[model samples]
Target: MLISSSYATSPIQTYKQSETKPQNVVDEAPTSQGDTVILSKPALDLAAKEKGREFSNSFVMQVANQSNQKAEEMLAAFTYGLNNPLIDISSLNPATGNGATYTRTGQPVTDASEVLFASQNESLLKRNEILIAQEREKGTSAATILEKVMQSIDQQPQSYKDKIDWSRLSS
Candidate 1:
């Protein structure tokens, strides 16, 4: 009889070997259909166009949001400019940066007050355009639309009427 030696075997690895498999392990989840769908050139172009339209819509919305903020600022400036005085120092400070600063007292020259007047004129013009479009859609007469606009203008404060430029309103 001879003595036998017993040796324990090494344990098996639970994880996969990198040498046999890929280093970057991608998820192999099951899909409802296949992994990829083949589309014609026209279909691809249509999808791209739809995506562009979505982006354009979003950009228009962003512009509208900024316009609303600008409108609000114009209103505030107009209200403040009513009682306070405004000054422009562009002659003295020729190199001064563009933009108005609000303080206890207003400026002497072109200031927030000017901005208010300009912006109000532009806004009124835009409002007129929209109002005309709306009235036309409802089959309203041109004279009726003019009367409506006049009535609305009459409802505004006399102080505002005096400050805002009325020359552009005719056009």
Candidate 2:
């Protein structure tokens, strides 16, 4: 039986207006990760040629030389070459898995992760400098505060006069 999806739903029924049963239909939504790719057949042919490469001593030496070189330099050369990357990012469709178009979740950096990491070191440094500046600005020393307190005590002779006032403390 070939029942078409288009002909399945025709009349829209309402609970408040109509006595007829309402046709409950579900709509399919398209999901996406949104990735771009290239579909170059020439690139694929070049990859096939590489896969069937006659790896002689010279080929091995060339590869070793490229590998020994810096990654950026190697990548630059490879990008310029026809057999740049075997993986065909340009020829992928999720509806039919026939190509190498897959989503990689992160941006790979050539630099160290610690370098890439954003730190509060600057803020911490600023705060430390601020604390040091504030400390410097505070001209009143610990010894000075203690001396002032002692002077105030000396001004009141009764504070030094050994009178405990035990009756008031007890009450």
Candidate 3:
């Protein structure tokens, strides 16, 4: 008689490998020897240029979204460096002769004021229309055009001396 014996096999043995640190891990902290990396001049300049470009792009978008009237107001404010133009009558003390108080007379000041105002308004409207046409022709936004214009202005030396020379030449 042949007897077959079956014995339970040892449960499958499993062993977890020990964890090892990654080979590429870097220690970025400055060394006690005071070793540090400094940005080169070119890198700094490039960073500054990128920042200026970003600011210009943002400014252009802001200006582009504005209406014609709003754009004109922005232009005027930038040119004059004044956000709000008001008479500020409260600051006027007539006794000090620092400010003049106006009295409404039956006669209006010379009709020239009206004419000048109309001409100036017409000029601004025409300028804005031209700018709009240029923007359309270039397939670009007003802000981009304005930014280019501003850059050109910035490149020119606009010191007091330059202004005096310009005035002399014009006169």
lDDT of each: 0.39, 0.28, 0.35
| Candidate number that wins on TM-score, 1 or 3 | 1
Clashes of each: 7, 2, 0
Question: Pairing residues by index, what is the TM-score of model 1?
Answer: 0.31
Each prediction's TM-score versus the true structure: 0.31, 0.16, 0.27
Cα lDDT tens digits, model 1, 29-82, are 788767688999999999897653422233222332355454233233322322
Q: Comparing candidate 1 with candidate 2, which one achieves the higher lDDT? A: 1
Sort by TM-score, top down from the best:
1, 3, 2
Alpha-carbon lDDT of model 3: 0.35
For candidate 3, the 10 contiguous residues with the lowest summed lDDT are 8-17
Give the alpha carbon lDDT tens digit for every residue of 28-86 in model 2.
Answer: 86756664466599998998876634322322223323443432232222122211111
> For model 2, what is the C-alpha lDDT against the true structure?
0.28
Misplaced by over 4 Å in model 1 are: 1-109, 164-171
